[model samples]
Target chain A: MQPESLEAPTNRPIYSPVIVNNKSAHHLFICEGYPSREFQIFYSSVDDSKKTLLLVSESDSTIDHDSILVTHSELTAKLTQLLGEMPLSTTIYVLGSEAFIWDVHSVATQAGMVAEQIKMFAPVSGQRRLFCTHCYHITEDVTHSPAVCSGCQRNLLVRDHFSRLHAAYVGVQIDAEDPDDLPLPQELI
Target chain B: MSTDQIKVRVAAVAQVAPMIREFTLTAVTGSLYPFSPGSHVVVEMPGEQKIYRNAYSLLSDSHDASAYRIAVRLQDNSRGGSVFMHQQVKEGDELLISPPANLFIPQWNAQKHILLAAGVGITPFMSYLPEMQRRQADFELHYLFRSKQTGAYQLELAEQLGQRFFSYDSDQAQRCNISELLADRPLGTHIYICGPEGLIKDVQSVAEQLGWPDSVIHFEEFAAPKPGKPFTVELKSTGKTVQVGESESLLEALEEAEVAVPNLCRGGVCGQCATPVAEGEIEHRDNYLSVDEKARQDCVMPCVSRAHSDRLVLDI
Candidate 1:
C-alpha cells in the first residue's frame, strides 16, 4: 500500500447535497450541466431568508425564476462581474464536473475569493485528468492506471496525489523500475 | 542569558510622545539579524534587583537590519521593564535582546488589509507599511488615540499614508465606529488590530457580531502577566521545587532553577512555553490556550499562568 502522505488530498470535494453554511450573508450557486437531482436538492436547501444567486451554464427546460442562464464562453466573464460586486460575506458553491468546478474555483479565486468563501461539490463523473510528471503534459478523461501519456507515450501509474494549482493528479511512468514487470491495469474508483 | 540573545548598544533615545520613548539599538558586533514586518524583540533590562525582559514591537523599516527601533509607553502601573527603559536606559548602554518573533502578521492572500491601531499599538503596523507598499497591497490604516501629544507618529503617519490614513482623536470627540468600518466590506478583506485590551476585545466582538470569521480578524495583545499571590512548583522529573514570586512569572521561576523551557514572546501570547501538568489547579492568563484547553487543566502556559492551589506538580 502507498504511504499515507501519498494519499488523495484531504480537501478533495465531497458531495453533500445540503446547505451546511447558514452564517454567510449571501450565497452564490454555480450549477454547470442541466440541474441534476443532487443540484436540485442543494439549491432548494438554501435558506429562504438569505440572499442567493443561481447561475446555470447550460440552458435547460427546468430553468427556475431564480436561475440565470449563461453560455460556457461567457461563464468566466459573468462570474468575474458577480464576484467583483459581491461582499466579503458571500459564499460560493460550485456544482459541476471535476474540471468545470475547478475552472470556476480558479476564476473565483482570481477575483479575490478566499478558500473559506468557496465550496465545491463532487464531480458528476469518475473520469480523471492526469498530469504526466516526465513531460509536464496533461492527459484528460483518464479512468484507469497504466494509462498511456498522450505526450510521452509512456505507460503511467496515476497517483492519487492531487495538485490544486494544476487541478490534476500526478502520473509517473509505471515501468521505470522494471520495464518487463508491468502491473496489470486497474480502474480507479 | 539564553543562547539566542543578541547584544546591542542603545544608539539614541527620543521622547516621541508624552509617555512614549523611542530607542534606537545597534548591534554590538556584526550586523543584526533580519526580521519580517510585524515582529517584536524582547529587550532584557538589567535592574539592580532583577532582569526585566519586555517584548516591544520593532518600529523600524523591515528591510533595514542595521538598527532596530522600538517605542516604549510608560504604564501607570509600572511594570519594572518599561520603568527601567524610560528612566534608567540611555544612549551607549549595552543590553541583551532576544531575536525577533512574530505573532501578528498580515494575511498576504487578503485582497484588502484594514489595519486598526489605538495609541502606541501602531508600532507593528509602522513596519508593515514599507513592505505592504512594496507589494502594492491594497490597505488602509485607522488610528485612534487620545490626543496629538500622546499619539506617537500621528503627524508622520498622516503625511506618509495620506488618503489611506484616518485618525480619531478622543480629545476632539472623534470616535471610530467599529461596526460601520467593518460593514459591507468586499470578499477577502482581512483586518489586523493592535491596541489596548479593551480595543482588541471591542473590535473582535464587533467583527464577530457583524458575521466576520475568526480567521479574518487578527490581533496582537502585548499583555504583561498580572502579579498574583506567590506559589510553588514541583518538577515531576527531578523532584525539584521552585518558588514563584508574586511579581515574577512561573516561566521565570523555572528558568531560575536552571530548568530551561523553550519560550518566545514571553508576554503569554506565544505557546512555546506550554508545559504539561502532572497535578494541581492552574490559573490561566495566557491568550494562547483556548477556553476548552484551559478547562481541561492538563497543560499550563508557564509564561503567564500561575498555580491556583498552593503547589503545582509539573511534568517538566
Candidate 2:
C-alpha cells in the first residue's frame, strides 16, 4: 500500500516512546502519519532566515528559482497541487536518486513552478526511524546495541526495515542529537 | 529384517561427465523393498572420515528396490557435497539408504503424460520411462541437453520409447519446438518440466501465454541461482529486521536472521521452502510452484527466490 491512506493501527508495534529528533517530522512526507519533532528550531546552519523557504531539488544545480517544480513520482502531483499556488517564497525540494522521481520532478517543473526546491535527504547513519507495530506509526530510538523497538519491544537489527513496508519505513534526518533521550509519546505530543 | 537392518552397497562408480556421476548400489540385506517409479533414496556418504546424508534419485527401475541406481551432478562451484560424492566414493562401498521418497510420479490412469527434461533433470524421468512402457500409458518424452554428447542414455531412452521420444541437443543447437508440438495435444495432458533456470523460465512464460494452469505443470530443479543483491528483510512477528546480501539465498538470509523457514532442498525444487509472501514483489527462480501460485504472489521458495522490490516483505 502507498504510504498515504495508512491508518493508525489499533494494535501498535511499539509501546515505549524513546528519544526522537526533530528531523523525524519528514515522515510526514509519507502523509496521513503524525509528524514527531521536538520543536521547530530556527536556522543555525545553511540558509539563514530572510523569510525564505528553501526549495530543495534532487539536484541543487537544476533548481531554478523562477522555474516549475520537479520531484519523485507519486507524491509530485499532490505536492505540486498543494504548493503550486503558494507564494514563490516557499521553496520546494525534490528527492532524486532514480528515474521514477526524475519524471515526477520533470513534470512538476513544466507546470510553471520552482523545480529546484526539492530537498534530497538520504537516510544517514545513527539517524534512523522504526515502524512501531503496536502503534503502526514509523517511530524512532529503540534501546540497546541492536536496539529493540520501544514500540513493539522486538529486537530491531539492521536490514529489518525492508521485510515488510508496514512498519519498516525509516529515513535519516540532518540534525539528530541525543537520539537516546526519551521524549513524550506522540499520543501526548 | 527391521528398517535398521537395511544397507546399500555401492557396486560401481562412474564419472560419466565433469558434472555428472552415477552410483550403483545393491541392497546387501538379501532383499529390498519395492520403490515406485520416480522414487529417491537418501544415501550416507563418508564425509572427511564421517558420514553425511545426501538424497539422490534412484535411476534403476523401481520394480526392484533390492538394487538401486542413483545419479549425482556436482555443482560447478563446489559446496563439498557433490564434489566429495564424485571424488571419494569408490566401487564396493556400503552406504546407508532410505526408503524411496518422491515428489514426482506418474498418474497411472491419466490419459496423457508429457515429460520435459533438461540435462541432469532427466534423472527422475529416467525412472518413469519403464513404468510408462509397462502400463502402455500414452506418454511422450522430450529430453533437452546442451549437446547430443551431453544427452544421457540417448540411444537407450529412444529405443525404449520409440517415436514418442524427442531430443533437443544444444551442442548441435538442435531443440524441438515444444510450443508448436504441444499445440495439437488434447487438454487433459499433464506437462512436467525440469531443467536450468533459463530454460524453466522460458517454458513457464510460454505456457502462461498458452493458458496452461498449475495442474498441468510440474517440475524440479537440479540447481538454483543465488540472488543478485544484499538488501533489508523485516520479520513481522518479532518486528526484527536483517540484512540479506546478494550472496545469500533468502533462506540463508532468514537463517542468519534467526528466523526458521521449513526447507528440505535448498535448490528450489522441493516445496518445503514455500512460505507466504504477505507483501512486496519477488523475482521467482524456482521450479516447484505452479504458475498460478506464482501469479498470486502469495507463496515463494526462499531457498532460491529473490526480491524485485528494493525491500522485500514476507509473512513467514
Candidate 3:
C-alpha cells in the first residue's frame, strides 16, 4: 500500500530492530522501565564513548553510572531541553510501552527531530490508546476492540488506522448504522 | 498548441543588471494559473530559424496570479533563446509559456531553512520570500554574485530581507563559508542550494562531512544542453533511422521525426524522457539516474543525454 495514499495506516512505525549508525556523532537511549536485554544489546552496538541514557521510572533504585533518571511527568521538559542542544548528527532510541513511546515520539518531533533521526523499539505491552472520531475523546490502556469512548460513552470500533499527529488508533461508532446491533468487545491481537 | 500552454503578453521589461533582463508577463486572455514558490515555466522563443524553448524560474510573488515575472541572463556563448529575449523581445509582445511546474519547494515541517544561491540562480528564491514571510518561516538567504553591476536584485533583496540576507561579492573577494554555515545547525534544519556546479558540489561535500543526512539537503540544476557531435539513432521496431543534430537534443530530434516520447522540464534533472537502449554505448547526463543505473548503460534520458557511439538502436 502507498503510505501517501488515503487508504490505510501503512505509515505506522514498523519498530524494526535497531542497527547502529556508526557515522552518528552522538547516541541517545530513552527507556521507560529498567533497561531490557534488547535495549542493552542495542546500546552495546553503539560506540561506548559517545552514548547517553535517560531512564523514566518511579523507582529511586541504583542506575547505570552515566544514565540520568527522570519521572514520567518530567520526560517532556527533560527531552525538550536535551533535544534543543543536540546537533543534527545525533540518533535517538526510544524503548517503552506503545503509549509511552509515541508520547516521547511526539515530544521529540516537536523539538525538531525528524523521523529518521529517531528510532523506536517494539512496544512491551499490547495495550493501545484510542481516539474516538465521534466525540474526539481519547481512551487509554485499551487492549480490546469495541472500547467505550470516555467522553461520549459510545461503543467504538477500534481500527488499525493510526494517525501520527494524534498518536492514537482511530475509533468510530460501531453501532451507528443500527442502534440495536452491537458487537461484543474482543481482545485485540 | 498544447492545452498546458498559456498565452502571455509582456507587460513590462527592465534591465535589472548588466546581463540580466527582467520581464513581467501578464495573461493575454484570462487569469493565469496560480503557482507555488520555486516553480518555472518554459518560454517558447520564436527565433529566425527555429523555436527555442527555454525554462526560466518564476520570480514574482506566487500569491499574485495576475502576472508572472522571470529574469533572463544573457549567456556569454549566445544561445538563441536568451539572445532573443535580450535583443528581440519587447513589451506588448505575445508569447507562449508552459504552465508552471515546481520541483524545489521548501520542506514545510523544517525547523529552519537555509538558501544558498549564486548569480542568476537566485531567481527562484525571489518567489520563495513572500510565501515564507507569510508563513513566518525561519529562513536565511546567502547570495554569491560577481559584483553590483551583475548581481540582479541584490540591493532589493537586501532591503526587503534586512539582516537575514547575506551577500558575497566575488569582485571584493568575499566568500561564503559553507562549512561554518552548516556546522552546529539544529536537528531538523534543511539546506537548499541553487548555484554553479562548483558551488553545489562544495556545499554538498561540506554538508556530508558534517554528518548531515541527505534528506535535509536539496538542490535544483537546469543546465542548458550543450552542443555536441552529431549522432544517429535507429528504431528497433521500424528499422528507421533519425539523425540527431549538434544543436538539438535527442528528444527534440525524436519529436521532429514524429516519434513521440514523454518529456517534462527537458532539463536532465527530470527523468521523464528515459528511453531504453537495445544496443550501442550510451552517454548518461541526467541527474535522476543513480550511479549504478548509469553504469548499467541499459537506458538514457534523451532530453539531455546523447550517444557516445556512432549509432544507437533504441527499444522504441
Candidate 4:
C-alpha cells in the first residue's frame, strides 16, 4: 500500500523509500540507504506549492552518472528545475560518515550552494543500520546473535563508526512540551 | 628549495585529554622531510568538513621527517572548527598538511636562551627544547601551565628534560614573576616567549627593563581583543565599501566587500593576515608583524589587526 504521509522504515530490509508529502504544499523528502543503488525521480505539477528536502548517503552514486564522484550536482540541478515550477525553499542533506559529510559540504560549496543554506548531517547509532555490502542488514548486535551471511560481511568494516552515532536525531523539531527534549536516545549502547 | 616536504598518513591517534588528541602521521610520499625547530603546517581533511583550514605547531622533532606529529586541543566554545576536528577526525584517516613553518626558533649561537610558555603555548617550545639540547646550547625553559594535567605535552617533556624544565602551576601557586625569573638569567641571553596576552605583555615590558633589545626577544601571540563596534572599510582597488559589524571581523568585512586577500590563521597568528594598505591608517593588533613592516603601510592583518581611524582604505 502507498504510504499516506511518507515511508519511514527503521532497522528493516526495505530501504528507506523516497518519502514525499504533497498534501499541504508539495514538499518532498528523499532518504536512501547503501547497496541499494536506488534512483528516484519526482514529477510535480506546474502549480505545486511546497518545499523539498533530499537526504542521501554520502557514499551513494551521483546523479551525473558520468562521474563516479558522490556529489549531488545532478540531483541538485534537477531539483532546481523542479523548484522553478513551484514556490518553495528546498534543502539537500548529504548523509554518510563524518568525513563523507565534510566532503559533501566541500563539493556542495564548489557546486555553488550558499554555504549557510546547505544542511549536512550523519545518522545517530541504532537509528540506522550499518550494513557491510549495502545489501545485507548487519545490526551492531550481531556479536550476541548467531547468524552469518555470504554477502560482503567481511568488507562490512565500519566507516565513520565513531563519527556516526546511533542515538542522535537529525531534522527533528523539538517542542517545549516534548518529553524527549534530548535528540539522542537515552541508551546508545 | 628543500626536499623536506611530505604528506604523512595517520598511523595512530591518541586522545590525551577531553580537549586534546595527538596524531602520529607517517610520511607516505617520501622517506624524510626536514623541518626547523619551530614550525607549523596547514592540514586538509576529507569531505565538506568545516575545519577545512587550520594551523597546528609541529611538536615532533625537526631531525625526523620520516614521520610527523601534531597535537590538537578541542575548543568546544569555538566557531564549529575545533569541535569538528575533535569529534569527527580519527585514526587511520588521511590528511594533507603543509611543510612546517615557524615564527619562533631558538638562536643557537646565543650564549644563553630562555623559553617561556603558557597552556598549549608550549607546542613550539616543546620542539625547541630537544633542538637546543642536541646543539648543547645553554638554555632554561619556564613552563607556566594552569594545571599539570592541562599542561599539554607535560609527560614527554618532563621525562626528557628533568632538570632544565621548570613547571609552574598558576592555580596552586602565585603567578610567575618575570622580573624575578629574568633577574637571574645571565646577560647576553636571547628570550623566546609564547603564551596568553597578559603574560606576553608583562614579559615584554620586563624584558625591556632588563635591557633586552627587541632583536634578542621573540614571541608568538595566539589571540587578540574582541572587536568592539561596527566600522567602515573602503577598498582602494575595487572602490567598494562595507561596514564591519561588531559580530564580524575585518577579514569578513573584506570578504563581504568581494575583495580577495590571501589569509590563513584567521586568528591572526600566521602573518597570512598581511593585506596591502592604501590610503588609511590601521590599528595594528597582531604580534607577528614587526614595527618596520607596520610602518611600511603596505600590508595589515585584517583578521585581528583593525583600523584606528574612522574610515580606512586598503590597497587591495
Candidate 5:
C-alpha cells in the first residue's frame, strides 16, 4: 500500500537548510534576548548594511548604534518586514531563550521562510515545555528534571525527540518499563 | 478477499464548457455506496492499447446514490483516458468504476475555509461545496478560468453563492494576485486549492511568504504525471525482473507482468502504491513522501516514481 503520507507537496516537514559552514548567506537578520560575545564576533565581519539585529529585553532603549532593542510585539512586526522582501540566499540567525528562538521561528515560517534559510543558537536555555507523546500533554516551562504532564498528570521523562514542525520536545512516561518506580533525576531542556 | 467491481451506465452527457463534457453515471444494480464530500473514484475506460484507469472527482452530492457525475475535458495532448472519455463514451454505455476514496477531507479546527480552483481542477471543489454549506462553515470560492463561456459551473456557482463566489478570466492576461489573496488573513484560516501546477505553486509560495503554515495550506494537483526514463524492477520474492518502459509506470509494468499491487488513485496520491526499495536510487516524482522519506531512499511510489538507477531492487 502507498504509505507515503506527504502532507504538503512542496513544503518540507522538517526544519532544515540551517546555515552551513561553506554555504553563502546573502541577508542576515539577528534576534536575541540580549547581545552576546557570539553576536559581537558575528557582527565584526558582516557589513552594517547587510544585517539587522533586534534585541528583545529592553523597552524604548537603543543599546548599540548598530542594533535596536524592541519588545516582543515590535520584534514580530520588524521580523516580518525584514523577511517579507528578503531576496534569495537570506539566512536568519536567532539567539536567546528557548521560547524566544522558537517563537521567532514560528513567525518566520508563517511569513514563508524555510528553516534551511534560518539558523538558531539558544543560549538562554533551561526554558522547557515538553509535549507528552502518550498523553498529548504539554508540560509548560517546567525548569525541573522530573516533569509532570499537565494533561495526564504523570511523571514524565522528556526525551530529546524534537519536532521542528511542532517546535516542542517530546516527553514519555518515566515509569514505562519499571512501573511504580521513578528514575534518578536528570537535567532537562 | 476480492475487490468487487460495480457496473454503472452513463445516463446523460452534456457539454458544460468548450471541449468539456460532464457525464452522469447511474448504478446498474440496486444502489451505489454513499460517499462523503471531497472523494474520488477510479473510472475504468477502454483506451487504445490497455484499460485506462483515471481517478475523477464525484461532482454529485455526497448523499446521492441514484447517480454519480464526473466531468472530463479533452486534453490537447490526449492521454488515452481523456481522449476516450471525450470521443468514444456515449450515453447509455456501461462502464466499471471503483468505490469512492477520499484524500482531501476538510479540517475541523480551521475558523474559515478558502477554496480556490482553476480550469477542470474545479471538479473536487464541486464536491466540497455541498458539505461546506451543510456544515454551515464560512467559506469563499475563488475560481479562475478562460472566460464566462469556457468556465464550467460559472452561472450555477454565481446563482448558488450570491456573493461568496469570485471569478477571473484568463483572457484578460490578469491573474489573481496570490500574495494579496493570502495577506492579512484571519488567524486559523485554512485554504484548499486545486488547479494547474503554476497556480498551485503561486498559492503555496505566497502562503509561505505570508507565514501561512503548511498545516493551513492544502492543494490537490490532478495533472497527469510526466513520462520518464525506462528502468528495470527486481522483485525480491518472485525473483522476477520487469522492464518498465519510458511511458509505462512501475505499477503499470508490474501489473503487465502479472504482479498485483494495491492502488486507488493511480495518481502519485493515496499512497496505495508505495513500494519499499531494497537498493538503487529513485526518481521520486510523487508528492506523497516527506522530505526525510525521500532522502532516505528506502521507498518509492511506483505509481509515479521510477528508478534513476538502471536496476531497482524492490521489496515487493
Candidate 6:
C-alpha cells in the first residue's frame, strides 16, 4: 500500500499546463514541461515569428521548432541578451514550476521589466512544494505524507490553501488538537 | 538642540485659492531642510492656548532648499490647526517644525505617470513636475477643483505645463472621468492619485476594474479621521489597558495612558504610527496599508485605525 499525501490528482494535472491565455505575447519563454498540444495552441496564437520564442528546457524536443537552450548558464545568457536587446514595449510570458518561474521573474525584474510586462504561469506537474505558515520555511519536492517543518520543527500537513503572495501551498500543524492522532501518511501530491 | 526640529521664519503668506492659503517658510539661520519631491513637514503651531501639530506637504521645488512652501486649506470644523494658520500665523514669525519626511514618492521606473489631483491635493504633485520635466518622462496631470477662481496654480499651470495639464471644476459641472483617464494606458504606466477620500476610492476601484494591479496604482490618503466606538487596548509588555473614547484616536488614548509611540502625520498618511498587533482584530482606517496587508491583520496604525474587537493586544 502506497502512502497517501494530503492532495492527489484532481483529474487535472496541475504541474503540466502552466498558463493558458491567447494574449499573443511578444516573447514566449518555456521551461521543461510537456503539454505540447496546449503549447502549440498558445504559440500559434502569437503573431511574432521572428525571434520571439526561446525554449530553455533541458529536454531535446521543442514545440514550434524554434530556439533551444539546455543548461542554466545558457538560459541566463539568453535571458540577459534578450532583455538587453528588447525595448520596454516587449511583453514576456514565462511558463515553469513555482521555483523555476520565480527565478526567471527575479532575473527579468532585475533587468528592468515591470511586473506588468511579464506574465508567469505555474505548471500542473505532480511535483508539490509546501510552505510552513509558522516559520515560513519552504519544503520543496515533498512527494509523500505530512512532513516535519524544517523551519519551526513542527509536523505539518500541506493544506489546500495556496497563497499567491507566497507562491506555495500553505502547511499547518497536522496534530494541533490531539498529538496522538497524527495525520495518516499520504501520497500523490 | 532638538535634532528633529527645524526653526524657520514664515517668509510670505498668500491666498492661493478661496479656502487655500500658501505659507512660505525660509530657514531662520542655515539653509532650509532638504527633502524629496513628495515630502511633508509637521508644523508645530503654538497658539495662545496650545500647540497644534499638523503635517503639510512641501509644494515648492525640491531643488530649492532655501525655502519650503506648503498650502493649508482651512476646515470649518478644524481642531484649531488650519484656522490658526490662516487667521493668526504671521509672516516673519519664527516657528518650530519637524524635518521633512517622504511617505509618498514617484515611480522613477515608470514609462508614464498619470497624476490625479483634487483642489489642495495638487500640492504633492506640484513637487513632482520639475523632476518629471527634467527627466523628460511622459506624464499628465488631471486637476479637479470647485471652480476656476478656487483652484490653486491655475494660471501657473497653464503657463508652465502647456497642454499637459487638465482641469475639471465641479461648479462648472465638469468631471474627470476616472475610467476614461485610466483607459488605454501604456504598459509600465504608474497612476498616482492624491485628493479627497472619494476621489481616491473611486479612482482606485475604477483602476482595479480596468485590470490595473496594486503595484502600478499609487495613492496617498490624508483623509480626516472619524469618530468610532470606544475600545480598549492592552499593552503586551505592561499588561496595562488603555480606554479609548469615541472621540479620541488610539494614539491619543495610548498617549493618555503614558505609553509612548512614534507619530508624524496624525491624518494616517505616514506609516510611523504602525504598530504590530499581538492579538485581537483591527479596524484599519488608514490609507497606508495595501489591501493584502490589511487582509493579513497583523499591523495597525493606531493614529487612525480603531479596534473592532472589544479589546486589542498591541505589541507596543
All models: lDDT?
A: 0.84, 0.57, 0.85, 0.57, 0.75, 0.75
| B160-240: candidate 1 lDDT, tens digit per residue | 889999999998999999889998998878899988788888888887676666778888885677789999999999999
Model 1 chain A weakest 10-residue run by lDDT:
A1-10
Error of 1 at B51 (Å): 2.1
Can you rank all candidates by DockQ, best first?
A: 1, 3, 6, 5, 2, 4
Chain A TM-score, candidate 2?
Answer: 0.28
Compared with the true structure, what per-residue lDDT tens digits does model 5 show for residues B1-316? 0266788999999999986789999999788889877888888887768766778888988877678899997877665788899889999999999988888887754557888988887888888888888888888999888863358998999999878898888877757878777766654467888877788788878766654556667788874656788888999887799998877678878887878888877878678888989989999988889999999999989878898899999997
Question: Over 4 Å off in model 3, which ranges?
Answer: A1-12, A44-49, A58-62, A70-74, A98-103, A151-157, A172-189, B234-241, B274-280, B295-299, B310-316
lDDT by residue for model 4 (B66-157), tens: 67777776653444445656777777777677666776666664556788887777878867877788888878788887663457766777
The residue ranges of model 6 lying beyond 4 angstroms of the native Cα positions read A1-91, A95-113, A120-189, B1-3, B47-50, B148-150, B230-236, B239-246, B256-258, B277-281, B289-298, B309-313
What is the DockQ for all candidates, taken in turn? 0.51, 0.01, 0.50, 0.00, 0.05, 0.07
At residue A99, candidate 1 shows an lDDT of 68
Model 1, A34-117: lDDT tens digits are: 777767777778776564545555455445676667877888888888777777777888877676777787887776676666
Question: In candidate 1, how many Å is residue A142 off?
Answer: 2.6
How high is the DockQ of candidate 1?
Answer: 0.51
lDDT of 4 by residue, A77-105 (tens): 54444434432123333444333344444
Number of the predicted model whose TM-score against the real structure is largest? 1
Q: A127-163 in candidate 6: lDDT tens per residue?
A: 5567898889988876655777778878888765555
Model 2, B1-316: lDDT tens per residue? Answer: 1254358788988766446888888877677778887777756555663333455677877776667788887766644567777887789877776667687777553447889988878888888988888888788889888642356677778887788999888788786786775564443456777676666667677665554444456676565445487767776566677776765577766765668776655666778879887777878878678888898987778878888877777775
| Model 6: per-residue Cα lDDT at residue B80 | 72
TM-score of each: 0.90, 0.49, 0.87, 0.53, 0.64, 0.68
Docking class of 1: medium
The TM-score between candidate 5 and the true structure equals 0.64
Candidate 5 recovers a fraction of native contacts equal to 0.00
* Stretches > 4 Å off in candidate 2: A1-189, B1-7, B17-19, B28-33, B42-55, B94-98, B224-262, B273-302, B305-316
Q: What TM-score between 0 and 1 does chain B of candidate 4 receive? A: 0.80
Q: Largest DockQ belongs to which candidate?
A: 1
Question: What ordering of candidates by lDDT runs from best to worst?
Answer: 3, 1, 6, 5, 2, 4
